[model samples]
Target: MRTESVELTVLCLIHKNGRYLLQDRIKNDWKGYTLPGGHIEPGESIVDAVIKVVVKRKKIIYRGE
Candidate 1:
């Protein structure tokens, strides 16, 4: 059988100052405060996924790095 491509997503939520990041998708399938991450290449680890999402979404530098 031919292999089918798949996409994966993850959310790394960060709560600070008594608030959290939220996203409202157009699909309306889901709505809420969520640290969203997704569509990372295969062989990538969870930590990398989180960092990629946080940096892209928040535009904040990773101090720990």
Candidate 2:
């Protein structure tokens, strides 16, 4: 017997000053705009995963000032 697995992800609403940001659908699965998100890695928290994915996609990093 074999076990199947599924990856978990979280979608985030990026916004600024009452404006909401979204991503343009480029995949064949869905059409139109979508929120930014990615798969949750092993031993990674929801918050951490969100930040990591967002940073990777946006190419922005925080220095924790």
Candidate 2 clashing pairs, residues 3+ apart or interchain: none
What is the TM-score (0 to 1) of candidate 1?
0.60
Off by over 4 Å in 2: 1-4, 60-65
- TM-score between model 2 and native: 0.72
TM-score of each prediction: 0.60, 0.72
lDDT of 1 by residue, 7-56 (tens): 87777676779977665555566655455666676998878878777786
Native RMSD of candidate 1 (Å): 3.4
Q: Which ten residues in a row have the lowest lDDT in candidate 2?
A: 56-65
Candidate 1 C-alpha error for residue 26, in Å: 4.7
Off by over 4 Å in 1: 1-6, 26-34
Highest lDDT, which number? Answer: 2
Model 2 residue 62 CA deviation (Å) reads: 5.3
Give the winner by TM-score: 2
